[model samples]
Target: MRLRIKREDLSAIERHSKQSFPLECCGLLVGRRTGTEFEVLEAVPAENVKRSPTLFEMDPQFVHAVLSRAESRGLTIVGFYHSHPGVGAYVSGKDAEFLKLWPGVAWLIISATRELIEERRAYVYEGDEIRELKIEVY
Candidate 1:
């Protein structure tokens, strides 16, 4: 599977990651699924209730609001994105635990250092395995 995101949208997510430096930032990936690819339309930032450097928990109320907004606009919550400040862009054990709950959802992991983003990678958790998904930013 593949995921495509606009350059501007990538920038937005990166900026959010930078702004939330030292703590993990998270948000929803709102867009449409096309063929074998997920085209991201927006990166909707959400408040990380955990607000911890190594963990992220989206606010329940904020998530509900985002879901309602997406449904109203005919957009699907295809996946989600989060930043791992000062860490590699790899799915961690905690991430896998959460990813498994959403079997077909795509996950975008952004690795950031200080105020700069180092890498961004996509993945999907299916059948108890976390597999990498090709990410095309254009």
Candidate 2:
């Protein structure tokens, strides 16, 4: 699968990640999906109710609002994006558990610090398994 995101939106994620550090930042990727491609239209930042450096939990009410807004704009929840401050961009145990609730969507993780973003990695859920995806920034 391929996850395509706008350069500005990726930059926005980086900024949000840095602003939320040393805590994790979470957000939704609003877009359209066709076949094996996800085209991200927006990166909607959501509050991390967990407010912990190693954990993140988005507000369901906030998510609902985003869902409604996306639907109104003919967009869908293409994926989820989050930051791992000071850690590598890899799925964590907590993240794995959360993945179970959201299937068939891209999971984009960005590793960052207060100063800069380190790396970015993406995955998709398929047939009860998560597989890495190729990311394209436009």
Which candidate ranks first by lDDT, i.e. highest?
2
TM-score, structure 1 vs. true: 0.94
Clash numbers, per candidate: 0, 0
lDDT of 1 by residue, 112-136 (tens): 9666889999998876788898999
* Candidate 2 lDDT tens digits, 25-87: 999999999999999999999999999999888898999999999999999899999999999
Q: What TM-score against the true fold does each predicted structure earn?
A: 0.94, 0.97
Strongest candidate by TM-score? 2
- Which sections of candidate 2 miss by over 4 Å? none
